[model samples]
Target: MASGNRPVLTVTGLKKSYRSAGEDIAVLRGVNLAVAAGESVALTGESGSGKSTLLHLIAGLDAADVGEIILDGVSLSELGDAGRAALRRDRLGLVFQQFNLIPSLTVADNLTFQSRIARRHDPKWQEELVERLGLARLLKRYPEQLSGGQQQRVAIGRALAPKPLLLLADEPTGNLDEDTADEVLALARDLVARTGCGFLLVTHSARLAATLDRQINLHAGVIA
Candidate 1:
């Protein structure tokens, strides 16, 4: 744990299970962790170690069967479905491997979409992110017009536009080649630092994990 630091995220005895067929599959078992503001933590695990499930729970997209997830001092269990959604929109930024951009919207529109929805739209910040992400030249181009790497860059720009308190990325560079992945991760790290937000990156690449401030490995759903 980092002393003298304000925690942006705190998880205590987090657990989750799923009903698969006739059996209950326990995914996470008593996992506890904390992430400090402006810190970057890399989470690595085997495919079925429940990495994505843990991320979903932390993101408020899914409920945990047991344990507490506190983000910025608010407990996720205390928030109703709508409240969680609002919290996510207002205080959290997420980037997925799929690069979920609006196909019909231009790059610029896609970039500022979430911030606009969250009512935290800052034109100056958005402009800076666009320039930093190299999306300034492709503002008018649709997602379909961009390559995979380009779309991912747009996705990163979109997540960063809101200046959220925490950013969650699930294998954000999974769709890119090694060289491009490194580039994108570097850009993400730089932006996260400039924004002064905490970051949790779920990845399998040891090389990539080494670049972060700390690495947390999940074994059978528990931090090892």
Candidate 2:
């Protein structure tokens, strides 16, 4: 783990709401959290508990109605749409339950896609990711040619290739079986540590949540 006291992510009094059938629905209210460098934090919440909403807000995919999100010393509210998009591309790594690997690209190309676009590709680091993720042998294979776990591993490698300041994953292992979920998550945690990047993982499985360095629950639109 990288030795640093400063947090890679900080959320303060974060709030968001939406209109539903003419009624206002609050998803997150006064939610405050932080993730330090090299730390892995698990976010567990019941369905519709705003877990995905918070993640979307953090990733700049959606805007928060109120509150503040500071990522790697930059505030989300300060950036415009294009700036936020650039930040997401350059400073944040995201993974979802679906293995969104490019079907036409080989594993090698898929792994380096994000980094290359971000202009932060490091050959040595990419090589290390290939070796660490056990993707060396599958480099020439396409996504369709790999198993679910293998494809997820490639997704993870793609996310980490740029060494972003923080990694946000939403139900990243939801589509996998127990053993495969555990294996993929273990690789993610190890790689997050290796990169010294803060990790915030949203998971429904309490068993999986307990494996992280810290765990937090969201309930009734607040951190409970």
lDDT by residue for model 2 (1-224), tens: 22466898999999999999999999998899999998999999999999999999999999999999999889999999999999999999999999899899999999999999999999999999999999989999999999989999999999999999999999999999999999999999999999989999999999999999999999999999
Residue-level lDDT tens digits of model 1 in 24-108: 9999999999999889999999999999999999999999989999999999999999999999999999999999999989998
Task: List residue ranges in candidate 1 displaced over 4 A.
Answer: 1-3
Question: How much RMSD separates candidate 1 from the native structure?
Answer: 0.8
TM-scores for every candidate against the unseen true structure? 0.98, 0.97
Candidate that scores best on TM-score: 1
- lDDT for 197 (candidate 1): 89
Report, for all candidates in order, the number of backbone clashes: 0, 0
Q: Flag regions of model 2 displaced more than 4 Å.
A: 1-4
lDDT of candidate 2 vs native?
A: 0.94
